[model samples]
Target: MFFFMAKKDRDYFLSFIAIVFLILHLHVSANEEADRIISLPGQPKVAFQQFSGYVTVNEVAGRALFYWLTEAVQQPSSKPLVVWLNGGPGCSSVAYGASEEIGPFRISKTTSGLYLNKFSWNKLANLLFLETPAGVGFSYSNRSSDLFDTGDIRTAKDSLQFLIRWLDRFPRYKNREVYLTGESYAGHYVPQLARQIVNYNANTNHKINFKGFMVGNAVTDNYYDNLGTVNYWWSHAMISDKTYKQLMSTCDFQRQKESNECESLYYYAMDQEFGNIDQYNIYAPPCNNSDGSSATRHNMRLPHRPHSAVQLYSGYDPCTEKYAEIYYNRPDVQKALHANISGHIPYKWTACSETLNRNWNDTDSSILPIYRELIAAGLRIWVFSGDVDAVVPVTATRYSLAQLKLDTTISWYPWYVKKQVGGWTEVYKGLTFATVRGAGHEVPVFKPRAAFQLFSSFLQGKPLPKS
Candidate 1:
């Protein structure tokens, strides 16, 4: 067919093709600019820029993941690009990581405004908060079945696609040093995605300069996590010794399906014996108004902080998620964020998705193998815990990491922030473990300054200050 064309006609057709390509390129560039957020409602004046929108991960599936990128506060081009995910296996990074934890702005109590977080991670790096798995938060899919069928593998694959396609939108970040950070179930997410990037970079021209990952209060090994969790409850005096013995004897932590005896004792320990204290933070007061449903959700792995204010962290607002829900659900807020443009969400914005949580299909019982693989790959892996969190407690993290049997480079010692003992830390041959002294499951929320210091050290590849 090509050989049949006249010379002049071939040149004309080639010119037309070039013109169409230019138009398409301009259209995409325009869409990128369209996603820029001039300012969120009630947002304080800031020098840095913000952008939020959806990146379609699976065109055939109509699955698009929402991302909010907060550029670094100073010399953005020179800063690294840090990607953050919050773990519910089905959670909104926007609600928790962005609005509450590490993002630049915190939603005010009135839900009418925002304020600066002095410890925003973006102060040092270009922070990208992603709401993943297609059904969490503002991220959505036109295909209904995609929501019901979610798992670690699919989530990681989609996130890799998101990062790849997202780079097409913001090409400046293509070669930037990237680090994956998350907490809780992201213990699975951070490492899994890092593994995906490692494989992808090996096989393809499209590479993500993924340096390492850091997860706080993360769920690593089911066996070790459950074992350590039971011990933490007993040692912390949260549950009766009898219940602890029952758990240890009846439950096989490696078994995905527990025996009836194990299930019963587990519920009893959490429901009856653990009492009304906030499981996320043992010493902190529970939200009086919360029905306490979150504590029992998906084996108590969900964030248990609820819709009531608490005085920790200098007025650490437990209700920040609530405020986030309110603010993001507003039509104005959605429009500004360039979210839900298709009007296909069919639900209010939430910090976490109960449907995805319940139906999550394939969870790797342990992520430790991936940790080993990535560690050998020489990724800068750091695992930290908020000591007070009973759910996925520090003991659980310690137990899980000990299974690695890595050589210790530094003995355990207190790491200080402003002359106060912030937490304890130990450096292994390839990984670092640290604890936030009084923090809960959400370290940045409970100890922002310390969390920031920890993040700074991670990026700089420096030891935590010993003085």
Candidate 2:
């Protein structure tokens, strides 16, 4: 059996040969896969076709390693460049950005029409799709193994390395305003990466132009984000009120040690399993405890294990060909699976597989303070939320932000697109928070109109869309 180092245990001083097994392949320039600088077919809409670049860093064994992205064409002044990362701590941003979110296309739910989004965000911002952390998708390492969860520090290091090199590859945009954005657990990813940029600017003599950040349905604070969000989800009718009140009273939000086997009322309620999830036999989206039902809010619990990972990702190949290219079964993705690593290590289930169950460290020492630090340093911070997600619901986001206590008065307004009110906006303390009404965890997939308006505001560092 192959053994690997937990990120916490890795000794930087280990012998190079002992770490050689971690080098899955040596990345000599000749052997490295050059990134595809895509062209948007010179359509009347495009000023330029596309640009692409890669960030190369050394493997744990000191071998060359790389991650890259394709930047869709954009009008320099009219459009801002937005780098989007999806938070699996392992999932590829490109898979989510291109396949699901607003990068000019989307999957047809019914199969007849192409289901054009009519509100793609990239039309307003130059979209860049990144495959990060070296093992998520086309991203691979010559390194035979990776520390599971890899933690926030390593993710930040890799992302900073990626940003510095990516800027080097496309210097024309060096001065162009850049925004860091993502969804799901990216509550941490966006800020963590942003913190690095802020730190680099403060600590080093170098200057890589960075503008601001945006996070949707994110995991902000472990206690408030995880436990409080669940409670707020119930209050919003996504779950039962009784379940929430009970959880608030009995369930300790801080420790948040959830498990399926636990007999706590919290577990008993979420353990709800319908024999099948067919519409006729559906468990109604929970409402307040007053709704006629045996289930209570106390019954709602974060899924014990991540949605699909704890159950199974094996033998499941979802329909992806309908969208872009289906690379789920590719030999390259299959080869990078660290099965020998703990089951805690994740693999894609469908494309967005690493949602709930993640070995990530959600403790307090993360980028929270760094966000305040950045705000103090004059960085523009925008926190956006998708109202539909029960997990990481917007209310929980509100709870966390209220704590920041920024000096700017919160502005309640609406963002308009095509002259129609698209979403709600609040700007405070040099930070703006927007809520996409119809959207879920992945906002672009559900609310592209608001997404575009957002990037437009993001690039300009303006307030969020007016509702």
Which candidate should be chosen as best, given TM-score against the real structure? 1
lDDT of candidate 2 over 1-467, digit per residue (tens): 12477554455435555667456333322233344433222112434344333345554533122333334445545556678887655565655666556665444433322333466666666677666655554454454344344456666777788777666555556777788888765677788888888878877776767878877777776566666566654655544666666666675555546543333654544455221121100222321124554221121333222211111012311222222324433333323321112222244324433422355443333345767877877877888887665556777788778777876575687777778767788888767888876666566655566677776777677665444
Q: What lDDT, from 0 to 1, does candidate 1 have?
A: 0.86
> Which runs of model 1 end up more than 4 angstroms from their true locations?
1-28, 290-314
Candidate 2: stretches off by over 4 Å: 1-33, 37-54, 62-79, 107-117, 147-149, 238-242, 259-267, 273-358, 361-367, 418-420, 464-467
Identify the candidate with maximal lDDT.
1
lDDT of 1 by residue, 1-467 (tens): 75689998899888999999899888777877889998898999999988999898989989999999999999999999999998876788988889878999999989999999999999999999998889999998989998898889999999999999888888778899999999988898889999999999999987888899999999888889888888899999988878878788878888766778777887787778877666777787654446654322325432221222222444565556668889999888888899998897989888888888878888888898999999999999999999998888999999999999999999999999989999999999999999999998889989999999999999999889998
Residue 373 shift from truth in candidate 1, angstroms = 0.9
Clashing pairs in 1: none
Residue 438, candidate 1: Cα error in Å is: 0.6
